[model samples]
Target: MNEKKSVTRLDSTYMDQYDAHVERQGRKKKRLLRRLALFALLTLIVTSSLAIYHVQQRMVYAEKKEEYEQLQEEMGSLKESEENLREEIELLNEEEYVLEIARSNYFFSKEGEIIFKLPNEEPSY
Candidate 1:
């Protein structure tokens, strides 16, 4: 028992204290590395989320822009059609225009008037 106790005391040397100090330093380094890795991971997650959000907004903006262009085209067509209708209405209010349409379409004639609708010799198609 005395020999074993002497041997154990010999093992507890200055080297053991130095080894303990080295182990504590290694633990602190590992902890710091773990914290850095965790920070980098969180930063990556936040950056990825922002990128996804920006892509979604761009998609929405592109869709809205296409819709706006289509509406503008439709609006232009509608305005052109309205103008054509207004011109037709104006022409219909004229007596000469009414007479011409009646003569051409219905072959109408006045008491002394004669309407002749000659067929075209050329094919329409």
Candidate 2:
């Protein structure tokens, strides 16, 4: 009877130890899983923010590029107008050109010239 009781006690103690070890292992696994989930969530948030930033930068770049192209076109037109104005200034410096403009715009004729006013014919649409 004494031997049987001692064997039974040993068996019970072994079972208790096994149960405790299983509980510890389970807790460790749960902690590791929680850490992994937190890390994954952080990674997702960071990547999403970076993606959004890049998209915004691309949009801004497109708008700026369009503005630059428009400015280039405007500058080209302004340069052409400046050339035309410079030509007109040069022509105005000539005496003959000035007299021509005065006769055409002000209807001034040389001393003994007969002036005729003609009406323009238009289609009565």
Candidate 3:
């Protein structure tokens, strides 16, 4: 009877140790799951922020592209005007074209030509 009682006590101690080990493993598993959830939440926030930043950058780029196109069109118009002015300058270098310009712009006349005077219109103000 004494030896049987000793064996029973030893079995109970072993069972208690096994139960403690299983409880410790359960706690560790819970901690791991919590850490994984936190990591997933942080990753989601970072990805969303980066996506918003990229979208804002694209909007800014689109506005700048539109401005660049408008500026290019304005430059093209100015270049055409410059080309027209250059041709006019070349034409004005000729004596006949210069004389015509002077006559039209300055109302110049030959020495023997008669000048006509017109009455000015009254101001409304």
Cα lDDT of model 3 by residue, 1-125, tens digit: 46654344455887999989999999999999999999999999999999999999999999999999999999999999999999998997899999887876788998898657565887788
Q: After superposition, which runs of candidate 3 have C-alpha atoms over 4 Å from their true positions?
A: 1-11, 115-125
Better of 1 and 2 by TM-score: 2
Please name the candidate that would achieve the greatest TM-score relative to the true structure: 3
Please, what are the lDDT tens digits per residue for candidate 1 over residues 22-109? 9999999999999999999999999999999999999999999999999999999999999999999999999999998988888888
The TM-score that candidate 3 achieves is 0.75
**Ranking under TM-score, best-scoring first?**
3, 2, 1
Candidate 2: misplaced stretches above 4 Å?
1-22, 122-125
Candidate 1 clash figure, as a count: 0
lDDT of 1 at 72: 100
- Give the runs in model 1 whose Cα sits over 4 Å from its true position: 1-24, 122-125
Q: Rank the candidates by lDDT, best first.
A: 2, 1, 3
